[model samples]
Target: MMKYILGIAALLFFSCGNKEDILLPKADRTIVKEVMDLSPIYIFFRVNGKDTLAEVNRKNSISTTNWILNIDKRLPLRLVIPEVMKLQEKRRGDSAHKNEAAQNYYSYADSIGKNLAFIPFTNVHYKMVKPKAEVIVFFDKSNKIWVNGLMIKNDKFKNFINEFIDKKSENYQFCFSEDLSFGNYIQYEIYLQSLKINNGQEFIN
Candidate 1:
């Protein structure tokens, strides 16, 4: 009887230990936890597969059109684009049933991509650092860039920006025109990210 009790106690201890292992925090848990805690509706992407947008829709818990799509860095662009397009398609379809003003807004947002339509409730994923000396970077619809209210040619951006960095500019803010394409906006964002800024910080407005 004594041996049997000891065996049972050991099994229970191991079982609890296994459960604790599963609850341990991971490196990427910060963003995941933040999104889960703040977002009313969110879809998580995984290596093997992902949670379907259809599944989320079917649940009827999503009251808003916006949903957080949490994707892994390793996920292929080909796999992700189709899903994103589906969301865009749904947004377009939703606009059809709305009033004329709402429809127009949707069209406008699609044309330039809405920058402020939705925002993260928490700043856990990224930091918002105030710049010491604000240097404004504006992008027009024609892919033209303006630095500190001065127009600079597309090819001359590197040279123009280097001057600012040389001046020890610590703060950078990016602004987009209403008619700018989403692709152009993303391209510039990538380009700016590769630059060696003093504080390595930029904000979109």
Candidate 2:
């Protein structure tokens, strides 16, 4: 699925859909892991509040070759020790002609895995997105994964509750408190003005 890139923001947003189209889909923990496994490594750059969500893989895509969205200070946050600089930096790794620095970052993130016990979950605040508040989400994979969600109280995450996860539909894992949103993991990519959030119930897409 290595596609070409040009315009920074290339996200495919969904909105103004039928009720059936807006149903919250559940992502099996295993499938969620697979989503990362199947795709190329993803990286994000945050400088001057501008974000560039890019993608790469062990195969074709690499470096800035596959930029998903060249966002200027949008989306959520990451727990990088040092803040991401605005200007793009070319480390020695970039000299490999394959963006080795990014590859290394992917390797490190992959090594950590999503298992909190093996590696603590790192989160970034979704401050720039809708609802205004800094929405924090768990991102522990080599590639950054995003999902549109329905806001619900009680921290309810998955629409379809699993055995290990909390059974309550209202209580999700991503929610900091009762203010949880159901991410349409099986849905589409996040795009500015590309989608709609409906009272945390069902979004346009």
Top candidate when judged by TM-score against the true structure: 1
Over 1-205, each residue of candidate 1 has an lDDT whose tens digit, in order, gives 0010111101111222331110111121121122221112222233335432221221322323334433322223334334445554554556445322221101001113211122221111112232234677777667778877799888888887787655354466555554443334444544554564424333333
Clashes of each: 0, 19
Candidate 1, position 111, lDDT: 19
State in Å the error of residue 49, model 2: 7.2
Model 1 lowest lDDT segment of ten: 1-10
Q: Could you give the C-alpha RMSD of every candidate to the true structure, in order shown?
A: 17.1, 18.2
Q: Write down the lDDT that model 1 would get.
A: 0.36
Best by lDDT: 1
Candidate 1 clashing pairs, residues 3+ apart or interchain: none
